[model samples]
Target: MRKRDLEIIKHLEMFRVMSRDDIVDLHFKHLKNPIGNANTVLKRLVRDGQIEVSTMHSPYLYFPVGNHIKKNSTKIPHYLKLVQVYKDLCEIEPPTEFIIEPQYKKGLAEPDIYCVFKGTPLFIEVQNSIYSSKQMEDKIKRYELLKQSELVKPFPTIIMITNTRYAIESDQIKVIQTPSIAHLIHKANEDSNTPPPPQPIKTNGNITFKL
Candidate 1:
């Protein structure tokens, strides 16, 4: 198998789902005519049964061959959100050191985005749905245990990108709504003099800001 194709498969397995543009941005951006080349590569992979495509959505989605392919499962808001964050991180100057999803360790809690910059790990969770109080408490406790345990040295800051207006009570977690990629990248590159990302605005009969 080709090196780039192998990387694409690895990404599909890790991220669970992706779009053509996602694949292009991650792997082929440096190539000449990236979009066209990405299309050709994806078609070849699909023909070889190395990957499968889903046409149920507007912009078709792609997944590895062994994974279950269902129309309903094809669209995940959280996955899309992560992809957007990934794209934004890629644009940061000096670049993001690394972004990954952690494996399920014996005593470690898995986070949505395990982003590393300057050797610091930021455990980011993109919460699209509201969790009950008990659920929230249990999750916090798990992270707390992970922090106290000798699993990860120095631990990592947990940032929750939540959809609701929640007032959390955890010293280990920071909650925010609708965060920009630049802001996140800046957080990782603390000493770097990158300016703040532009905030988003809404237009519904009147102009408003997204906070």
Candidate 2:
């Protein structure tokens, strides 16, 4: 198999679910006809039993072959949102490392994404639904426990992506609440008096902001 094909499969396995357009943007955008090329390649993969496709959704969602996740799993949307966040960060500066739904020892914090971007370690919590005050507090407490564990040297900052703003304060670790990663990055550049990065190369299937 080709290297790109393997990479695509690995991504599907790692991310749990990805849309057709997500695959195209990440791997085929450099080509002359990205979507066309993606469709052709994806069809072959599906035929070869390398990946599974769900036609229920427009543009279709792809999963690793033999994946346990149900085609109609409710977590599919959440995973897709996480993928978009990763893509946005890649447009600015590709993260050195990005892990989806990284797990920790029992009682430790579980973040939707754990990535190293521009030399900073970050733990991202993507809140699709409004979390109760108690739930939020418990999450913060778990993070606090994680910090105390010192499992990760030079603990990472926690970023909460949600529509509703919550007053999150902690002395152990920095917690940032933002509607989206783009807004957070833009604000960071402004604070440091640095110009925002150039516009993303692929605008389709992505949420674009002026930054």
The per-prediction CA RMSD against the true structure, in angstroms, equals 10.3, 11.0
Query: Top TM-score: which candidate number?
Result: 2
For all candidates, what are the clash counts? 0, 0
lDDT of 2 by residue, 1-211 (tens): 8999999999999899999999999999999999999999999999999999999998999999989899999999999999989988998999999998888889989999999999999999999999888888899999999889888778898889999988776778899899999998889778899776767654687867556
TM-scores of all predicted structures: 0.72, 0.88
- Write model 1 residue lDDT over 29-146, tens digit each, in one string: 9998998999899999999999988877656788888876464763465687787776775675322544546765565677778777446567777777789888777777777777
> Which candidate tops lDDT?
2
Residue 175 lDDT, candidate 2, scale 0-100:
90
- Compute the lDDT for candidate 2: 0.91
